[model samples]
Target: MPTVPSANPAEHLARTVDIVALLERGRAMSTPVLRAAVDRLAPPMNTVSSYHFGWIDAQGRPAEGDGGKAVRPALALLSAEAAGAAPEVGVPGAVAVELVHNFSLLHDDLMDGDEQRRHRDTVWKVHGPAQAILVGDALFALANELLLELGTVEAGRATRRLTTATRKLIDGQAQDISYEHRERVTVEECLEMEGNKTGALLACAASIGAVLGGADDRTADALERYGYHLGLAFQAVDDILGIWGDPESTGKQTWSDLRQRKKSLPVVAALAAGGPASHRLGELLAADVKSNDFESFSEEEFAARAALIEAAGGRDWTSEEARRQHAVAVETLDAVDMPEQVRAQLTALADFVVVRNR
Candidate 1:
């Protein structure tokens, strides 16, 4: 299949600027002042989070400009806007999500032995694991600090949703690390892992949206489910792309997932085949990539594997599930609890996530 154009991060940045403008006009939470404070709150651990978010220079000095895409922040804001609170009510919490997401990336790069992130040397590559771990730890602490300022949030309700998502994010990462050693995983377990690794934060984004939306319990639950399936779709698509995407277009190696033996969705689907593909993969497990050719599979062979993922229904299945969750997400917004236009916009963003190239 031909690769469609990837979404432009610069254009997405412009849209986010628009969204942030809308949130600022409502001016519910003093975000400018608070963002300033968070920037100043901690300066230790080499400030990798700050740099990752483009809040500071590589030298730990303050700078101006774009942070990593802030997709989670957008989801949090959109969720709130869809919920009708103007997203300003949830901006601080949204910022926490962005920070936390980057925090995970910093550590993930280290654990995965990735060298580059967003086209630059990864935190660990620049600073070593000990310092990278400290940086991630500091960001985690900072995320809680930011969350606390959310102000009188109901522990009985909104706060619980927020904290639960954060806790689950850690749990999910732990599961991903554990998968490095496991020889086989059932599809059901894979779904659970995706839920933890990918779904949890997205659920939190929508849950935060609902809380700020002033939505009731039932609608909030629906939104959470929407986020869950949306995340699953995101991960499955990522899994497929990991094996076949254009390294230049996607900014990742096509064979990296297979090389690292990640057991992504496509590989997972192929493993279910119980034939040559499965047999080959099983042999690769607990084995090292010794030769330069790595078993003589051509680039075209990898491309076929990508098509196999789509043909075997791994991609289609996840996409259909995303659409289903999207409908549920729309239903939550349509509940007369929120404005129609805001809900529609957020719904569109959900669709965009599934199809976005990167």
Candidate 2:
């Protein structure tokens, strides 16, 4: 595994702290507005959404720390700062983006049959999919309300971005679901699919930041491009990590994707390699074999499959892809008319994007 850039740790730590503080303030303004709108839409479920949002507990009691990492909002803020503006200029949009993201994740866990999230039982797992779906709806409504609360003028750029990104996310999810039954897929196509699914949102984060930062259309577009490429690179890295990452630290089982027969970037690349293990990967894909039977296969089976990915140049291909996208991210950051120190911080963050070993 490639070593994580030292810059990443530093930037992540600093950004995380700053973002957490920012969220603390944003929540105070945004949450009440969100709750009111949600209540207006689903008076019956108003209580449920409130509980899920961490306004209360299962018993409808008050609670804390119900909010998630708020990474999308953080990205929005960062994009604003990168463009030489105060981060909170994008506050409403940032909160909307985050709510939308969480909304998706809530439904995603239910659809994927996932039980855990953020170190706890997923909302669906605890509350059931029907309720979870309602919560998702609430999230969307809250997001839209947040956009509306930004007022006609303040909402112009941010709402446009949120709408575009939400569409991209739907398209990406459609493509991902379509891939489940697909037999023939290319690495390039997979990149496109994931780019829409994963890349669009990240792109939205940066784009919103720029738009709210009062950047010109050109600079905003550049920031959007940066987000798009970064999103792609991040997903590519995630696909790699999904297969090889340590279950203990990554909180994912080893070969989880293999077990699911997921045609992730590495798996597709291995199939394209056409070596001995490549042939086996083809056989497995063709025949629909199981990974729990991994021990039953040839002693060389696991190693051979991994070798096929390497031999077929899957890792290198992915690494190059990451580097390429990261270059775009840096390019966009550089193009922003921000202070040198601010730009440097963004650079450090760009490097951190694809430098993970996890």
Candidate 3:
């Protein structure tokens, strides 16, 4: 049986050839369509939208760095290429996926009470919850509107695909919130929730390009599976980073997920291990929760908890799981016949998903 790839930091870094550059290229191609759609919103709504996208400051001045890595748009365009279509043919789909992604981020930040994102105050923190909610709704609506502009039949298909994915995404978020209140959660349950919350949108982004590019259902479905597995790998890596990443590099507070008591994959896996380390972790977590002292942990205590989690094998398990999911993602690509260059790019993107540090 094939084992998970060894974690050679150098090898991983070697494979990590600036996937962000491809994402940026896709962003450049799709930004005009996205801007036109957002501009259709009312005055303050447009302003809030612009701020959230990192195009402008809270004071409505044009500032750089409003958006994300544009990963979804890149996947859309790449999927389109894999289906034997020009990347431009996927522009509308790319824009639609990106809009929906930002909409989720806006709402998620509010729901999670996250004050900061990408090293800036979130929309809710800067603009208030009501405006944040409104802008999120507007973005979702605009995504649909943009898709419909693709012509009736294609628009209808894309809309159905996106809406179904959106529903699953919402359900996943709901499950995630609910998990926080529960005393015990299994790894299987955690995976399901992450798959729904993170995987659904990525699946849509990947398949939408194929649909728009006139690929048959089989090719689109294969790409969707590829994205689904890739999403799982992405989230698993993100879970690892949440606990161990550099605050300066990840642009978040140190141990941010643990600070929030989030039941991320590694945390749940640690809890489920049911040994001395697991018991110790549970005690620490419970103490924090019972005393309402989540913020009071010293660096030493945090380090101890992280060590306990590693001893419980949570870190190693999650890392291997990420590699396993990445392997599956690459395998799924074989189901479709695409240009070698496109296939290589997609494979590289899959490797980057598991190996990325931030």
The true-structure Cα RMSD of candidate 1 reads 5.9
Candidate 1 clashing pairs? 79-209, 80-209, 83-213
Q: List residue ranges in candidate 3 displaced over 4 A.
A: 1-20, 287-296
Best candidate, lDDT-wise?
3
- Report lDDT (Cα) of residue 317, candidate 2: 70
Clashes of 1: 3
Ranking by lDDT: 3, 2, 1
Q: What's the count of clashing pairs in each model shown?
A: 3, 0, 2
RMSD values, in order shown? 5.9, 4.8, 3.4
User: How do the residues 143-231 of candidate 3 rate in per-residue lDDT, one tens digit apiece?
Assistant: 99889876767668888999998999999999998887665779999999999999999999888888888888899899999999989
Judging by TM-score against the true structure, name the best candidate.
3
Better of 1 and 2 by lDDT: 2
CA lDDT scores, all candidates in order: 0.62, 0.68, 0.84
Q: Which lDDT tens digits does candidate 2 get at residues 1-358? A: 4333333323444344433355455465455545666676564466666656666666667877336544456567677777778866766667777778877887777776666543346677667788889878778777877777666653677777788888888887777766766765788879888888888988887778667667778877877887888888787787877677666545555565554456778877777767776776677566554333444555355555666677777776776777777766666665667666555555555555576554
Residue pairs with clashing backbones, model 2: none
Which parts of model 1 are misplaced by more than 4 Å? 1-38, 55-66, 286-336
Off by over 4 Å in 2: 1-69, 289-312
Answer with 1 or 3, whichever has the higher TM-score.
3
